[model samples]
Target: MKRGVRESIAVSAVLLAALFILPLLVIVPFRSELLTREPPMDETEGEPFVSGDLDSRTVLKVKNGDTVEEMDLGTYLVGVVRAEMPASFAEEALRAQAVAARTYTIYKLQTGGNHGSEADICTDSTCCQAYISEERARANWRKNANDYEKKVENAVTATDGETILYGGVPILAVFHSSSAGLTRAAGQVWLNDLPYLQAVDSPEEGDTIPNYYSRAEFTAAEFKEKMLAAFPEADFSGPVDRWLKNAVTDSAGSVETVEVGGVTVKGTQVRAALALRSACFEWEVQGEKLVFYVTGYGHGVGLSQYGANQMAADGADYKEILTHYYTGVTVEPYSFALPG
Candidate 1:
């Protein structure tokens, strides 16, 4: 071969070798560290640090009495899971709850939470995620405390450092006690149209679950009084049936709008005015009282706890359950940097 041709061939061989060997050189050093690292500790009975690429030591400002105390993120989740869902639920459902709780906490931390304190979140279910101290939860569990604690801890450990994300950011992982056979889109229930919170069928929700159906009865005088209080301009002179006419509902059967005493009001407004369980309700007059038969519970805007349990019962894992409820979401290991 000519000298030029021979030089060109030598250069090509070197480039080919570099392309194949450089990646190995980069990865080989970390391989032993990756392989020999201890398996994540058993979280059932001890304070096992979360294993991930992100910081595991999250500090939570917890409101206890008038003073606030900082808590570990994992410990806080145990209490949150206990308050949010029943321990008797399937392990997968509990694991899903753990991830949702973590995602919610991080979201709140990212956005300024409504707690109005130096807290990342609150224990109040209405204000934020519900939580009970380990002592109180164990007390409430009574004879089943040990078993229940083990289950919740196992769930938290199994999904440690995991969160549901949309577009690489933690999402608003809102959840409810139950859904009306389907989850509602965020736009349908709220003013925002979050792409990840679209409506999805949750077929597992049905009459079999407790409080799948509920009734609230009020005397004509009482109903009239409540309506008048909410809508001062409401004309309550006619029969009760006419008062709640023209109920326009969304695709999920939740009352979106209705004519109450000649005033147009949203079903959510009616639910709040009457302390109803959900917007998915029907009202009727029986003799002298107004009766409301309500289906489902909670705001019906996110993962249904009962529905998740049913899915777990049907063999769906935590990842499947989370993805099913949160449309187009990825369950990925995440960690947030803690403040010094």
Candidate 2:
């Protein structure tokens, strides 16, 4: 080959490589997939995915409404961290959230996921982790937009490629906003009794959390209507005080079971029916209404965001916070990597 020809080919190759690399450099980590609601598929994997292995190049398929979003692991996690944790939280707490979000996504991928082969997870908070677009986060932060965005990005990057594992496998790393003084055991909130998700003390209380304690009042007639819709056999014939009876709760103050009317109902069932903030609640009948005194928010399971922040403030690192919330789990980096 002539020298000029070889030189010309090398220059073109370099330019082509630069073209691809430059875009990635300038592009922001934020991305949002706009899709209609996805049609239901056979969710064989009830919750998470299988095979706890991944590399830097791994891509996650996230179900957003009706469309599937494909993005690199790092990029997807940045959006997840921003949506899942408040950037105003301590840096360590944000990092803990970042690791939890990362572990959750990987668990979904390893467990084969539910959205068929098309997706490994979903954007719906009720289903999987919550994720948001850059614009939405910016709008929510307003004046603190730039700072908050950087905080989340740093949190994610700081813990890049890390995960919480149990028995060398990626656990279902579930988390919530707060707990009622204690996190619920896996068997208490889920079918399986995962050792790592044992009930543990949470540090945050009413003083730390704005809505640590809440109330939901329903008139006697309204209460009966809603209760009957869920528990048709519920007996609401007696006095308002007798409507809730035989309340059973755990040491952590999590209401386990209660008798509503004549039907025995789980606390979770009651929470869903009444739209209460947490399962840890007690009710009082005053006048013609029943007021439920609720404590904490979310499902009262797994890691508590507020608790984590408190721990961070107390001088605990991200790993320590995670280890405390998710018992017997190690915060470790993934072993698998792509060959250079």
RMSD list, candidates in order: 21.5, 16.4
Tens digits of per-residue lDDT for model 1, 64-138: 546678777887888899999999899999999999999998898888787665666778887888888767877
TM-score per candidate: 0.82, 0.80
Off by over 4 Å in 1: 1-55, 338-340
lDDT of 2 by residue, 288-331 (tens): 89999999898877899999999999999999999999989898
How many clashes show up per model? Answer: 0, 12
Candidate 1 TM-score over all chains jointly: 0.82
Question: Against the hidden true structure, what lDDT does model 2 obtain?
Answer: 0.83
Q: Which stretches of candidate 2 lie over 4 Å from their true place?
A: 1-55, 335-340
